[model samples]
Target: MIRIAISAALLASAAPVLAETHSIEPGDGAQERLQEALILAEPGDEIVLAAGRYHITDGLSLDVDGVTVRGAGMDGTVLDFTGQQGAGEGLLVTSDNVTLRDFAVENPKGDGIKSKGADNIVYHRIRVTWTRGPHEENGAYAIYPVESTGVLVDGVKVTGASDAGIYVGQSSKITVRNSIAEANVAGIEIENSRDALVEHNIATRNTGGILIFDLPNLPVMGGGNVIVRNNLVVANDTPNFAPPGNIVAGVRRGTGIMVMANDNVLVEGNLLSGNPTAPIMVIAYVQPYDDERYNPLPREVVVGENTIEDGGYDPQLDGADMLKAAFGGELPPIMWDGLGSLYVSGDTPGWTLGLTEQGKGLGDAQPAPLAAPAPAADFDETGIGAPAELDERLG
Candidate 1:
């Protein structure tokens, strides 16, 4: 028999390829058995999403590259896209070392777990929610990663995202840690990313709390070697329900930790409280672009050492009560707009807007108070975050 059929084809090519799980369960067809186990997963498969509530009507995709779509614990595996009749994202990963753990995803009409160009991705403890909280047709982003490199968003817990409840665009080696962005408009956004690492994290009632934008014509413009440390930006006074020509509807409600137009950015040890529009904001990307390789300013920015409280009293600017009686009863937790290159180390108490140009707005005001100066050395923490083997897949 030809030597027993060549030893059964060399014992089936020397057997050693076991790597499957695929336990998907949850009533009825379960969206065709969870999109047929993410299209018959291969490369080290593991699509176990079994623990109830999966009424997803439409969106669900995965290109499969080292798959691992686990579940059964981001509040017990819910995935109920409130009868989604289409797609945009309710789970759309384009493959490459994927690992979206402990799922939840509710009401995902448009973005609630999107991972494009997904590379070394690892969004652990995922829980994108839009339980009708902050609406504008809620669902802009709830853990939406884009154009990846090696991103790791840990312990996720987004809520009501009208635009940004943990959104990382463009992307490079990124790492948005711990995580818990609430009432979103922009609660944790790092647009046009680069070597990023917004640490710890706990942005509250979001309108804008932790945003490091570098805009100008997209396909990824020069963002920065970013690193916003130890966060807990509080009381982000939500109200920017974004949905009108959205760009976070010009986030303002109670902005906190916003650094527009990046470069070697680094804001440190945070814990700002009751952020009433300015619990640390450095600007200059005042929009008016054509992207000649854009450079809207914010260079070498650094505002270290923080633990501020009762920020900017209640000033949603445009001369709010004469700047809160000229910074006596409020307004002062660092708010600069004087076009970039900022650095205010300790004794932090600021104010600026002395804009000279760049899409001039605030009525071209000259607010003044933030006398910056401090960090001159030791700021460069090379190659920022997200690439320590993506934290061993959040084991």
Candidate 2:
């Protein structure tokens, strides 16, 4: 019996493994080969692309859960979709526990890399770009993950997106760190997402550096508990070329960081400079809409311990005309729209906006004019207001 047990243990130890690896090289019919590999892939499989340019006309989709798609390196492996015939995104991921890393995706007709309804998804050391610079025809988002949970985007670089270079929308527990975004409408945007942490990022030469917005009419609403910290948000004066009807189209050029209609957001420990518009803007979503389901006011926002320099001059008049008229053509480092109703205690409830006094060019929020102009009847025509009123007291 002891001899039989020893032999059985040895046989089990020698059993073959189930993990498989597939590699695709650059050549004719590369897309077909990749598609075949994806179709054949199972859970716990790895697919690798060789270090060369794979010119693909159709978008790629991976629906296998727990699969890893890897490339030689972000600089060496390129997926060029300039001649894409697909009408949608470059890469679509719908599987849970998937990992995509170490590759570059360029010039897709739509979004660069998008993951929908995926959980525990990670995108690391990846680069996505539009080579033609910012244009309305460029893709909407570079790295977009919507309706995802436990999403992580780390050490990635994105550029030249018409809407947002790195956008995480309708997601939860997202972490975006050690990334760079440039020359996009809204460089890095967290829209309608909750429990997001955006840190250690450099956002420059975009229309708006980092945006936290909660707009009406989406799968998710009322984003909260976001933290934007330890980031360098600078310059960001690129012209806004987003196609009309997109929420980011309203982003003012030269703005560094904007928090609009979100709740419980913390902006801290960031270096903001060279943004001609307001370096930090906290505004309510005053768009006229009949949907009472959407909360248009930001609540319990705290802006603390940030370094501000050389901002709030030469505003983007197209979006900041009201700010120009109100502040004599010069904005402040920290601006808040005082547009909510006063509580019975003579102070706004959770609607109070807080900013620390440790930064330069920080100004107290001025009271809104009594009988201020009502927002445009069209929801899209309403502009985000300039500084109105803030407490300047940090809690």
Candidate 3:
């Protein structure tokens, strides 16, 4: 029995490491090949996608576990989505234990890569771009994650996204590092997630450079996060306009890194500087739950060790006065946006009223006056910008 065991161990140790590298060319029936290879792959398989443009209209869904999707680097491999449907979202995830590295996903119409209901996913050395020369659509986001956990998004360069360069919502246990979110809607957004760590990232010239929110109205909750040691969050307040569903609607015209309704969260050791808007904004909640089909109030939020560099000067949307006027004195650092909100900080019970949209015409409960007349720009980036333009503070 000892000799048999020794032989078995020797064989196991000497087993050949076969990592099948599948190739997917432009018209190589890449989808079909990928499915087959994924089924046959073991723990250490690599699907090598070659240098070419893969025209996927509906985008790709990656669900296989313990697999790696390798490409010919960001410069060589491209998933070009110039025009597509379904909110322009590309590469949705439904499984866990996935690793996608060294590739570029260009979805001008939708999100670059969206992972939903996934865990233990790693996106490394990836680049997502939506800019061709000077013309940039909504680079919605390079990485949009929802209902995911244990994620690491690193060494990525995202440019020219319309909404947010990287929007992470309803996720937990995440880390974003050594990445760049430039000239997009929002550089980095963590909404309704938990146990997150955002560090060593560069955010520049997107609406709300780095935003974290609880958004209790999302039917999801947010908390337990940290933003530490980042650099160059600047020039995000462009107010470059677009219509709803135009991709740009979600970004490129708002505060820098809006944080709302989160707890156990810390903003420490960050070099947030030179933005067109406030460098660091910690909001109380999403507010006015009536619009999102739920109550939009926030609670149990924390702020610490943050550096707010300015564009904080707005004649109409004066956050300081708004806080002092509403809450007697000294606002909650960050409060919820909009004039239609029904709740405030230090609340114990959740909202009792279900979300209703009946008050749109009735106007804000106390509209915030407009800073200036509504430019032909986009208002979605700043929920209160147009409201401020309307010369009204709903809060």
The Cα local distance difference test for each model comes to: 0.87, 0.78, 0.57
Models sorted by TM-score, best on top: 2, 3, 1
Residue 177, model 1: Cα distance from true site in angstroms: 13
For lDDT, the strongest prediction is 1
Q: Model 1, 1-395: lDDT tens per residue?
A: 34245436655797654677878889988888889779766667788988889898899999978888898889998989899999888989998898989979998888998889988899998998988799989779988889999899998999988989988898899989988999998989998889998898899988888899888888878999999998899999988989878767987889888998899988999898998878888888876888699899898899999898877787677768888787787888898888868988889789897998888889878897988888889887887888898788787
Instruction: Write model 2 residue lDDT over 1-395, tens digit each, in one string.
Output: 24345436555797643667888899999999887777667677899999999999999999988888899888889999999997599999999888888999999999999999988788888999899888899999999999987788888899999999999999888888889999999999999998888999999999999999998888799887788889999888997999989888878888888888887777778999988877877777745656668887766666666888854787764445665566555565665665432111111111112332212121443334222232222222121211112111001
TM-scores for all predictions: 0.40, 0.81, 0.68
Residue 126 displacement in candidate 1 (angstroms): 11
Summing lDDT over every window of 10 consecutive residues in candidate 3, give the lowest-scoring window: 385-394
What's the CA error at residue 368 for candidate 1, in Å? 10
Q: lDDT (0-100) at residue 218 of candidate 1?
A: 80
TM-score of 2: 0.81
Query: Which whole-number lDDT from 0 to 100 does residue 151 have in model 3?
Result: 72
